[model samples]
Target: MDDQSPPRKGCCSLRCGLALLLHFCNVSMMSQRACLSLTMVAMVNATDAQGLPNASTQEPPGDLRNPVYNWSPKIQGLILSSITYGMLVAQVPVGYLSGIYPIKNMVGSGLLLSSLLSLLLPLAAGAGASLVLACRVAQGLSQGTVLVAQHTVWTRWAPPAERGRLTSMSLSGLMLGPSVALFATGHICQALGWPVVFYIFGACGCALSLSWFVLFYDDPKDHPCISLGEKELITASLPEQVGSGGKSVPIKAVLTSLPVWAISLSCFAYSWTNHIMFLYLPTFISYRLRVDVRENGLLSALPHLCSWLLSILAGHAADGLLARKRLSLIAIRKLFTTLGLLLPALLVMGLLYLGSGFRGTLSLLTLTSATLGFCTAGMMINPLDIAPRYYGFLKGLTILIGMTGGLTSSTLAGIILNQDPVSSWFKIFFLMAAINVTSLVFYLIFAKAEIQDWATEKQHTRL
Candidate 1:
């Protein structure tokens, strides 16, 4: 068995199980992340046209009758954006650590810690806005490790040919989290109170942490239950440099790599649009469409669900194309990246003209999100292609840079919406389109899918 060997046959492969568990890990993290977006709606006291509390505003269906705060738009923005701030601080360090430590411990402990924090979120909300912001930041810090660790895991488990599907399946949980959270949060708040949303998701995270500890091993060779054949297939499929085991990161080389920067920039562009949708789509539906909370939850979930499904399909498509030799790896990466960014850019712009037509707006947004799925086959997985041995460090570094987009988008969107929730949306949409186009051009110019020379053991030894 070697990199060029035919694909393994089996539906019950251990690597697939790894992907499945990683998917659940992602789902748990994302559900916690999305809880605040819709829960905030219920947490805040309804305001009138003049920015004063309006007791007459009708409560949405399933009112939990929880206490509401009067936090301003700017403050709410700070709270929503607070998680990214923590993520920025933790990403690189955790990424570097993933290469050195047992991934099961790092991921399991982080998620467990985050889950515990989620249980405190309702209490924090009751104390003050500042406490809530701090709590969210802590959650962000804990959850940050999960993403980098996921890439690190695949660096060991995924063969080159199966990389697209495996990584995409795991990554799809990013979208699934929101889809499930948004749909459930509204209903949960209505039936069980807003606090229950955090409690429920938090418990799920704790259980997932336990499962990861019991079942996951950092390397296939270390897993007691993986079959000999499946282990050999995974081990042989990885590049020699990666299979040789972890080495010190080539810091200078990674810093100067254009492909690395290209991936980071594309991630930034993608995160900008994604964070806005995740954190604010419910708000947009509430303000623009005047939908009730139940409808808002369902509507907000639509785009993310579409994205989840499309990412899986796109992953398979990318692998299929590679198997058929229909295009070079670079060509497939570029083509899919183009579809992901360009189509979303155009469709987001289309939102500016839709006014209050719920159907049209949702349609464009769903299409936009669905197109973003293509990136799972593009730059999202390119880190593995270019530097499988250093994937943890690269994933961390790139995502640290990329998450700034989330920080920037959330903060700026908050400021913009603070001015006039109605008119300010146009600026947000236009700005999103502009950023997407700019990043897509840069990625097209610099991105490469081949393993870099510096990523090889010989180059690493020289460094």
Candidate 2:
């Protein structure tokens, strides 16, 4: 199939508008991660008016406490950890369902659930850490389902030639969400209490979820406003099996595919390294760089802004290369994947070795993250490359594998920094560099962009 030819005709403008749907979805759900982190920072340094622990005291704040001064670090960790656990448990089932059912409904419900849960976070915390953990877990489960289902849904909507551009544009919300969340949440914390963080994000989620149901459709065939020409263009451009493959799944073939493993392993590595930045970078800056808490959000958002802009450019570049037939799909995917992981790995080491002043260090880290953004053009688009029919399922598998980065990387950091996290920054940076290198090796050896035979061959479909 000619996956990279110019469009024969323009699709409905609404088709383009549909990208904004996921764009908003990405922004709303992804914001929660950074928002909660910002809130945690506030709570950690908070002390009561009387110098006791109290969440209610702004005049004389107290540390995060059960009553007025007794919150345990262990409990804090538990509340955060539950979300990861929820994501791990629900991803497979959600992925499976998205492929067979109406993905719009699944994704919409997930968003709605997560938004509602966000509203309850402050209440859950008031009840105690265990209750808070449960709420976070619920949020995680919903988010996992919604995010994994995205490629599956996009598979139906995106033409093969433009997949990278469209996907990246939607995924750009990932970058924008945290960038805004950190800064906005920080400022909001100063003016209002921490609970407002949840309320604000929750409101955004609620609004976007409503927009999704109204604007989104499962397939081009189902869109009420699609013109005949656009509908034909979309349907003909799509791989045949996408509409048909869900009825039968080749479990063993998919599970054992070398490309799948390569993608999964690479995802694991990327997630591990990125999770360090996502979850711990703010903490690291506060303790090691001696940044003030109020400014942490704005500073932390810098890398994300760099990443967001770079990813947009990378996506257009990848699509342009394919459209011009300047490179084979496999070569394009491989080259960019290498660029994404390889440069970041090396630059991160440079960041560690240079020990440049704060500005220089931030510049290097920004460049490294910008390099990582190229993965938006590479592995992030691979499931659509190989398995349009089962794209969601494959995406779910990779994400499930990738999320271990959350548990494993953070746990490693905890162990390595048992004495003092500030002093242990070198170890953390080195570990991230090593992970990036390992993922690059695995990807170079095994990842493939060609459609797997099992995707289209009926004889193997039932396994």
Candidate 3:
């Protein structure tokens, strides 16, 4: 149970294979989520020379061959946030189901549904903004199961010693999705049209779901292709309580736990800033810097790309520190969480003073994203540390609470920008800084890295 023990060899084990697949799963899911951010620039009509919609003037359709709607900033914000609304509704139910069902089925089905939805998005957009919103919400509902199921997968496969690296590697796809999607969406939209973005990403999602069903197994013991040594290593490394036949989740205890709330608050702050960046940074670059779609895509992607790389590195560093016993588990969580939240806040605030210097602005945004990556080692993975048995459910609960920030941030940014797109950014970034500091203080005070008592307590009541 001492997780400080050195990790065994066999980097190519079945669990590692699962981690890779999980990485691709996140990539596919996020690609679906992010493709719209850049695609919308091309999807909308009546844009000025800067490619942003002219706030003063509204125009009708030009070409039906390469169709573009006349959705306002407020409507665009609603479309962007609709997915989170669906996610909020589905997360708790799916999280609970993940614990009771085979994770492979839950995750594969979710991705498949979302892929089918992606293929339909172009048609939805063609019909109207309302239809597009409906499509996004449905896609959100399907993808909602993904992050929760990811936590469930790790509960069965990731050994405590290797948890940091394994989970981080898999979750890095969350950032990588936006990076790849944004970069590719720009060129794809420009060349083939915005609809092609959906078709290509949808095809990729279908392929990934097929691969997942063929290769992924809920438990090592269930995997037919796993080597005996690898299976034994994974099975032995897991806690005895995990995957032991199901017991009722202690809902009251979980809801009342301060540590749970701590994680939730941290997630809220993180999701807020993260959503703002991925969802709107392209608009910001276009509106403020006056860049073309290709340049806008490349610039917007740089931050997420840096964040993805840094997340993988941070995971390795966190595991190494724990292995060497250089820091207590709680200390490591706090350290990384602080670095993740605090630095980004400071950098975001610095953006207030930088007067249109493209390099300075891009550097700050990239550093903000890169530092935010450290949270993958912090509150992001704390559910497994404290409640491995119910991590999926706990993650569901926290994400439900946390993703509200995504909804709020996107909608609020839309409302604020609706007032004045250029001058109002100061309000958005300042709000982000304040929320980050407040959440960090709460998390540092209440977050725990040890197993909770209720997590181990057995309850005979069945769900």
Candidate 2 weakest lDDT stretch, 10 residues:
60-69
- Per-residue lDDT of model 3, residues 208-324, tens digit only: 999999999887877787766666787887755364236788888888899999999999999999989979898888776888888888998899999999888888899999999
* Model 3 lDDT on a 0 to 1 scale: 0.85
Query: What total of clashing residue pairs does each candidate reach?
Result: 1, 9, 0
Root mean square deviation (Cα) for candidate 2: 4.2
Runs of candidate 3 exceeding 4 Å displacement:
1-10, 46-65, 459-463
Position 120, candidate 2: lDDT: 90
**Model 1: residues >4 Å from true position, as ranges?**
1-10, 48-50, 54-65, 241-246, 354-356, 460-463
TM per candidate: 0.94, 0.91, 0.94
How much is 394 displaced in model 3, in angstroms? 0.3
lDDT of 1: 0.84
Candidate ranking under lDDT, highest first, comes to: 3, 1, 2
Clashing pairs in 3: none
